[model samples]
Target chain A: MSSTILLQSIGFGITTAAVVAIGAMGFTLQLGVTNLLNLSFGNVMTIGAFASLIAEHWHLGLAATIIAAPLAGALVTFVLARTLFALFARRQGGAFDLLMVTLATGLIIQYTIDALAHLQVFQFSFPSGSTLNIGPFVFTVLSLSLVGVAALVLAALLAVLHLTRIGKALRALSVDPKLARACGVPMRRMINLTWIISGALAGLAGLVYVTNSLTVDASAGLDFLVLVIAAAILGGAGSPVGAVVAALVVGIASEVVAAVGGSYYSQAAGLGILALVLVLRPASGVWSGPSRDEVTV
Target chain B: MPDQLLRVTGATAGYRGVPVVREVDIAVGASEIALVVGPNGAGKSTFVKAVIGELPLMSGRIEFNGKDVSGWGEERRAAGGIGYVPQTRDVFPTLSVIDNLEVGGFRLSPKECKQAIAQMFERFPALERLRHRKARQLSGGERKMLAIARALMADPKVLILDEPTAGLAPRIAHEVLEDLVVGLAKLGRGILLIEQRVTLASAVASHVTVLVDGRVSYAARGDEFRAVPDVSALFFGSGEAAERSSWSAARGPA
Candidate 1:
């Protein structure tokens, strides 16, 4: 491929990376703190996008929808964690069992959303009017805004995780919950806050994704969940900056591949990279997210 | 309150009703170190766990600092000044040394926690140099020291250590025991240690209990026990104590 083609692909990839990073950070944080793969997390993202769509339909501004989606996602995930997941936590569900529980929760959420959206498709209206060109690449105002917003969210999340006292407690709890508890970390509150943060990020990612793609459906977030998980695994789970960096690389590589080849192999290229990383570092590769030892009881 | 910092009376605790530890009564006081020693499967570890609220007491009353803390949850007991370090798996191996200490400082304020961690670093200068390194990379002795230092973060009134020197070189083991006594003496923290090394235990502990087959067979002061040999045999085998005591004494040379 020519350098021009590569450069354009890189620019496009960075934008996609921005979206993926937000989702991956949310995915990683949820898995790290709860020790649940939370397959249902994609559904939470879909809910957020739909919530934003509803807000937009009511003539709310883009900012309002942006705020609305993550809020809605956070609330739902919080309820699930406190009411349903907490029960399973007490039973000491190991890695495999926890995965099943999260998968079930995901099914419940996706179907419930599918029922609400009437099983029909949604073509949500996003702001469209201006297209900007930054020296060889072009993007709409909405796409630019989505990238900007995702970047802001990612920065905010990293700051919260690294700077605050709460963040220290979170990192500790995510490493070893029993030790964290013994040290007097508020287990219940930390668990709840984690759900809120992760769920909200998932929702925001969904909204941004739908805006960029210019379409909405129940499966919007699910279509990209694999990429999010790959980014998280490629980065270390619980490392937000690492996840973002990995997401950027994956997005660019996949886009460059798509630029050269057909779209059919785009998703496959991302998976191939993840497989390569896992093979190279078997222990880190197998360490997809947090295990039960990380979650608070 | 006058005689004890912690008291467990008629305690029977177990895993899933299997009764690993049964009908045990023990007391510990301030400025005192109680050492519980026994062979493997003798349930010394189980009794320590029962006192710390990790294992449910089948039937018992654990009074701590004039309050019945048996019914309290593990976190509550810890917050109220009880600290427990399990035999192994006490430290988060994946996290850094400073981070592990920060985890143990969860109950304290940010300033207080930082101060406690700094104090730990001062006490363990080796850990200070390796503060940024992960616990997984540390040697067994270093890991044990980190676990103890982390448990010390809250300035707990009572510290319970299970087999603090279980598998270490003779010199490292002696260093750990010496560190343990010196550290506790500095804080005046009531210490409860479960040890298999009799000489080490007898050297550091003011009070010692020998648990055999899930019961306390002998409880006496270190000097009192040093004055006799037959009483130590009643719990552990006569020949075993002689071997361990001489080994530790020869190795320790203190």
Candidate 2:
């Protein structure tokens, strides 16, 4: 393949990476803090996108939708987690059982959205703007904004995680909940905050996704979520930096593969890389992410 | 006992309602080190866990700092001036030493946390050098020191340690009990330790309790324990450690 096409695909991949990073960060944040992989994350993303679309229909400015997305995402996610998820967890469910419950919950949400939206796709764009040329690549205002926002958000998250006591408690909780409890880390309060924070990010991920495609529909989130889940797990389920890096690698490879070969293999390409990494380096500490055993859910 | 930091009476606790340690009694005061040593299935760790609120008492009462914290969770107990170090997985292995200390002092203000961390660093010169290193990278003795430092972060009124020297070399285990454990007691906090090394326990322990078949078979002051004729044989004669599984759930195969 020509270098120009490769670079262009890589540029496009950056946009995909940013979206996946946000979603993965949200997913992994909850997974790390609560030790439950909330499979309904994709449905929550769809909810955020729809909330934004509803705001747009009211003729609110784009910024209003931006604010609405995370608000909707956070509220919905927190409620579901605290109510439905907590009930199941208290029933002596193990990590695997909790995962299944999340998966089933996601499907219920998808069906609910299907009925609400009448199984239809709706137009929702970021208002087309002038494109910018950087080196051999091109990007619109929205695409650049997505990348910039991703970088800023990631930086802010990293700072909080490293520099603050709350961050220390969070990291500690994720590593060992029992020990964290012993250390006086308030599990209930911290857990609630985790759901809210991750929920907000998931909502932003929805905005990142729908804003890029300029379309809103029930299946939009579920379609993109496969990649996000892979990125979250492969990134070690708790590290935001790891999630973004994994997202970039997977996103770039998929886009480049689509550019060079059949587009049909793009998703397969991403999963193949994950499988390859898992096989070749099965041990922890080799990668920045924690070992799979450390986080069973 | 007048200045007691911890008191447990008729404490019965186990996994899933099945009794592992039953009807036990123990107490520790400020400047006292209570050593609990027993065979593999003696339920010593279970008793420690019961006191720390990881395992709720099936029956009986636990009083800490004159407050009955029977229904409290581990976090509440910690916040109430109790610190704990488990036999294993005591430190967050992935975190740097400084980070682990930060978590230990989770509720401390910035200034207080900084001061506590500094005190720990000064107290453990080796830890100061390894502050930036992850806990997993430390030697066995260093990890033990780090665990103790982490538990001490909150300046808790009481500290509980479970098998701090389980996998350590004999010399290092000796150093832990002789040097660090003794030094910690000098700080005037009530310290409860579960150790398998009798020689080590005999040196610093102010009190010793021997458990067998999930019961307190023997109890005495530290000097009395050391003065006994055969410490190992006192509990090992039960032969329960070989027949029963240990450290797992008390229930059978669930």
What tier of docking accuracy does candidate 2 attain?
medium
* Per-residue alpha-carbon lDDT of candidate 2 for residues A86-112, written as tens digits (9 for 90 to 100): 887778777788888888988998999
Q: Candidate 2: fnat, from 0 to 1? A: 0.93
**Predicted model with the maximum TM-score:** 2
Residue-level lDDT of model 1, residues A102-194, one tens digit each, is 888887877777888788787877666598888778766766776788678778987887677688778877777777777777878898899
TM-score, one value per model: 0.88, 0.93
Error of 1 at A147 (Å): 3.8
Per-residue lDDT of candidate 1, residues B35-133 (tens digit):
888777889878977887777899978889989998988788888999888777788877789878887887888899889988998888989999999
TM-score of 2: 0.93
Model 1 error, position A87 (Å): 2.8
